[model samples]
Target chain A: MYVILVYDIGQKRVGKMLKLCRRYLHWVQNSVFEGEITEVKLKELVYEAKRIMDEDQDSLILFKNRDAKWMDKQIIGQERSPTDQFL
Target chain B: MYVILVYDIGQKRVGKMLKLCRRYLHWVQNSVFEGEITEVKLKELVYEAKRIMDEDQDSLILFKNRDAKWMDKQIIGQERSPTDQFL
Candidate 1:
């Protein structure tokens, strides 16, 4: 099964996640990874990436279950953290 | 165009979003609201809901563009604020 790691990144650290993960694993063009990804491994990736996120900013990482019928299109939105207040 | 507000709620504040918006507008059962929701009005709904989120927690709100081909099925996942990582 393909594991899609969909991220709502903090914008500033977009490529940092890629740099850290790409050397050790193969990443799909759309930011997904297929094959076995243990919970332990995912934690490591997030932990390392955490350094890139500012306390004022954070990132969202969703490990999508590709085996399931998921929406294939890229969803879009932008509400600068503070800006999201208005919804 | 239908403005789809997809929220990654801060666990404690789900109903707050619905309660505030449902009164003035009609909401679809699957967490999507369709109507001419002006940005000005949406801000009011979000602003009111934020009072319920904890200082340690925040919410992610995406105003899904419904005209686009979006996956209509319910997407599921549970991640505590500091837990997601290894993938």
Candidate 2:
């Protein structure tokens, strides 16, 4: 199972999400705001991400198959972000 | 450059995006809510998508890259959506 989390949010806390993903597994990700994580690894990623995330609004975790050719982009922010190169 | 459009929307318009892409290029896609389109092809996708969108709210186009391993998921909607398979 693959996961694509569109956690509808602003720009301030992108770092928080990325760090959380890093804490768990090796992922090919994009967008600190909107994450393209797989479901097999999602439970761990979300658990960690939720730990750092403040209780403000609701976020959605969209799940898909890994076989699916799913991709995400960074539209609103600057280029060459620190979050670009994933571990 | 790669593009990931988080149009911050509900569930009614996912189909609108996939149809527009099929009109343009042969892409490997995921959610219609958040699109995983390449920057080279972004201009065509965004232009056509913007035409169908109502413009009621502010949407963002977050551009990252193709080299970047960005992915997206389908969190809120149901399973086996028509928007899953891209042409």
Candidate 3:
């Protein structure tokens, strides 16, 4: 499936969360990531994320789609980190 | 269209951006918002966002879909703000 993950982590653990997410998905912008992954990999990514997050203060949201083509994306300002680097 | 808007704004201007986005979309979490809006309204929101943003330093991304049913949302941790409050 294709997924877009957005996170709001506590300042102290955000760096760790970023590193963990980078291993599984493309970092699209600050605290935002998106890419295609198998169900197993997605679960693994979420497992790691839970470790880096404080349930009381941090939030993590995942938007899933069967494929990227199902959605349309637009950018109005600087593309901090382009997800289509290879393409 | 149903749109999910994510922003990474400089600290100095983030508050203004948040206030502006709230008027057009549901606040799902920190720096993230989603809701149904007409094309004209989306354009207006983008126009206002551009004014509050520094093109060189900030980034705004919009993910649009024909309907929210096309995508799935999963929250792993705290949902800072619930989007389906009315539902």
> Of the candidates shown, which would achieve the greatest lDDT relative to the real structure?
3
Question: On a 0 to 1 DockQ scale, where is model 3?
Answer: 0.79
Candidate 3 residue runs with Cα over 4 Å from true position: A85-87, B85-87
What is the overall TM-score of model 3 with all chains considered together?
Answer: 0.92
DockQ of each: 0.06, 0.19, 0.79
Candidate 1, clashing residue pairs? A41-B86, A42-B85, A42-B86, A42-B87, A43-B85, A43-B86, A86-B43
Better of 1 and 3 by DockQ: 3
Ranking by DockQ: 3, 2, 1
TM-score of each: 0.33, 0.36, 0.92
For TM-score, the strongest prediction is: 3
Q: On residues B1-87, what C-alpha lDDT tens digit does candidate 3 reach at each position?
A: 888899999999999999999999999887889999999999999999999999998999998877778788888878888446222
Which lDDT values do the candidates have, in the order given? 0.42, 0.44, 0.87
Lowest lDDT 10-residue stretch of candidate 1 chain B: B71-80
Cα displacement (angstroms), candidate 3, residue B61, comes to 0.5
Docking class of 1: incorrect
Interface RMSD (one decimal) of model 1: 11.9
Rank list by TM-score: 3, 2, 1
Compose the digit string of candidate 1's lDDT tens values, residues B6-85.
44445457678667656534453333333445557756755665665553444334332323233222222222133221
